[model samples]
Target: MLQDHGFDVQMVGSRKAGLMHHEGWPGLRIDEIDKKARFSTPRLLPNVFTINAGSNDCLQSFKLDEAGVRLGNMLEYLWTASPDSTILLSTLIVSADKKTDLNVMRVNDQIRALAKQKAKDHKKLVFVDMNCEAGPDVRCLVDGVHPNDDGYEKMAKLWVNGMLEALRKGFLK
Candidate 1:
């Protein structure tokens, strides 16, 4: 949808499966960024950067502070790598299981606050709340974390709309 709109988009994923799927799409560039690897070069820069991760980080039993620190470092690296990039940071999605809902919510809140703070400091930063528009019936998971195809499509629509809205507001161009 974004490509149809003439935006040069590239997607990077931490997971191998995501990389493989995105690689098959025409005009879609996919890069695999290993969490354990050093952050050196980014495939896309100074245009748009969107992150749809962190569920794994949470599920891996990372403490809140650790997760924040890791995310902060990644953001810093991205910004440092491409200062002019329009950064779109997404809030974490809610888990399907009610047992982990509170944790997910907490992390989402932290991410939102962090994004806000980062935006205040960085002129090009834009925070997008993916969780806000996702209703309870969105069926956002296949297991209890990863979004199903339907959920992903919904997310994509939300993101496109959000980007358009941001563009209209002059938050991004």
Candidate 2:
């Protein structure tokens, strides 16, 4: 989308697309950087880093506080590695079940608070409230866990809008 708008865009994913790159998608740059490996040194930084993880982490039956701590550590690593990068943290989207939803909301609140604190400490850091932007009704999966096409589209729109808004606000130039 950014490429369509005339901005040079590069996509570095957690895994390689293998033969898919041979199809000639110039904008996509697949890398082997794992989400858990963001803490390492000499990190390859992008202008805008959008993290859409946590749902899987939450589904693993780990403690919420532990998950938050791990996530916070990852964010800290990203901030340290790319001090100038605009950090856009996304909240985990979960199923509509009341119990699971509450857990997701709790985790999201922690992330928001963490991002707010980081923003105060470093002006380059900003939080995008994907949970609110996507709306409560839009984040649900068919099994009340993973997102369907409608849910994915909602997420994509939220991310695109957030990136544009961040750019306009000078978070990322």
Candidate 3:
């Protein structure tokens, strides 16, 4: 999607992955400092950083405060690593189960509130509310977790629109 939008995108995604990687096998790959340090201190940093994760942590039944702390740590790491990078926080999508859906909402609310608050301290911090934008459209999601092609297209549109709004608001220069 970013490729089509004429943006040079560098993506890092793992199968069956969450923002918090388990110990033993992979050993905390998602740790904010570990993730940032993996890039080897490149000269050119990313212009934007969009994070749409943490559903797995919710699925693992992590407490709300723990999730919030983990996410907050990540945002702080990103801010310290790349002060000029615009951080875009995306709300988690809908899940299949009602209990999980509620959990998703709780985590997403935590994320949105954190992003808004952090934006005051770090002006580049922004948020894109995927739940509010996409609504309850099952067609936009495959298996109620991940997005399909159509769903991805919708997500791309949402992201583009959000970025455009941010640009207009002078969040991005």
Candidate 4:
């Protein structure tokens, strides 16, 4: 989507797609990402980061109260390791189950609060509300969990919007 907008893009990470390399791994939670992130030097960090974590944390009911703290810790580590980077943190996509949705809403609330605080402090973090913007349908879910292709397309657009928001706000250095 970014490239479609005429911006040069080169994704850098372990997961590879047609031409993008990303850090995402399926089924990983927020704490898990923190524990497994491996950018050991400033040279390895990218200028932009997009994080769509915490779904698994709410899904698995793991340290629900600390989701925000865990995300904050991860952001802090990333900031310290590479101060010249922009992070786009998104709320989880809307879920299918009411119970999971409750937890999803809970964690999303925390995410919003954290992002607001970070913005007030002038941190390089852009908060994307995927839950409302993406509009992933319960009927579009596969395996009673992940979203279908159309839903993913909606998410892709929101991601582009988030990056554009960052660019518009001059958050990228």
Candidate 5:
């Protein structure tokens, strides 16, 4: 998608999954990424990043109330590590598990508030709401947990809109 948009995209991180490098692994929560991303973030200077986290936290039931603070801390660390980078923060997508999805909604609300508050202090933060009725469901997800190919496609579509929004708002250079 970025290539089609004429933007040269270079995915950077420690792990090599398939053909691209990414900073994430399965079952990672916001706090885990907070520590894990440090290793790659400083070495590879990326211009833009898209973050969709907290699902694992909700699933694992680890520090549920503090997800926002953990996310804010992670964002702060990212900014300090690479001041030139622009971050597009996304809300959690729909979950099939009723209990887990409720937590997803709760964390997503915090994420939304965090984005608004952070935007007042930073111009590079872009808020992208990935939550909606049309999002992934029992059919689209793999075992109703991770996104399947179709779910991934939908995720890319959401991220594309956020990327375009960031570009239009001058958050992406």
Candidate 6:
């Protein structure tokens, strides 16, 4: 999605595409950044970062507060790495059942609250609600976990929209 916008992209994600880069954890996820991995660092700091994670963490049974603290750690790392960069923190998408969906919402709420609180300190943190952007269309999803191409397009549009909003507010300046 970002590449489609003419950005030079270098994406490294878990096999399950969660935020964490840990290797010792047991699960179906593969480590994307084990030792000896090539092209580990970007040539330049990014102007913006749109993060969509926490679904995997939530599904993995991480408590909401624990997820928030871990996510906050990641956010602090990004801010320290690129102090001038704009960070767009997105809410997790919907899951299959109500129980899991509630957890997703709880995690997302924590994410949004964290972003809001951090924005007060670092002016570049912004929240983007992907769940609201995706709406209530089950057909857009593939199975109960992943999204279809159309769903991805929708996500891309929402990201672009959030970027535009940030630019308008001079948050990207």
TM-scores for all candidates: the values are 0.73, 0.75, 0.74, 0.93, 0.94, 0.73
Candidate 3 TM-score, true structure as reference: 0.74
Per model, state how many residue pairs clash.
0, 1, 0, 0, 0, 0
Which of the two candidates, 4 or 5, achieves a greater TM-score against the reference? 5
The alpha-carbon root-mean-square deviation between model 3 and the true structure, to one decimal in Å, is 5.7
Candidate 4, poorest ten consecutive residues by summed lDDT: 35-44
Model 6: lDDT of residue 110: 86
Residue pairs in candidate 6 whose N, alpha carbon or C atoms collide under 3 angstroms: none
| 78-113 per-residue lDDT for model 1 (tens digits) | 767766656667876777767466666767777887
Candidate lDDT (C-alpha), each: 0.60, 0.61, 0.65, 0.84, 0.85, 0.65
C-alpha RMSD in Å of predicted model 2 compared with the true structure: 5.9
Q: Give residue 106's lDDT in candidate 3 (0 to 100).
A: 88
Candidates 1 and 6 compared: the better one by lDDT is 6
Best by lDDT: 5
lDDT for 130 in candidate 4 is 82
For 56-155, candidate 4 gives per-residue lDDT tens digits of 9988988889999999989988888778889999988877788888899999999999999999999999998888835676766785579888888888
Model 2 TM: 0.75
Backbone clash pairs in model 1 (N, Cα, C under 3 Å; residues 3+ apart or in different chains), count = 0
Query: What's the distance in Å from true for residue 110, model 1?
Result: 0.7
- Runs of candidate 5 with Cα error greater than 4 angstroms are none
Q: Which ranges of candidate 4 are over 4 A from the true structure?
A: 39-43
Over 1-173, each residue of candidate 3 has an lDDT whose tens digit, in order, gives: 54665655554323224553211122222344335443532333555666676777656555655676777877666666667767677887787767877888888888888888887775686688888756445666677766678777777777887777667667775
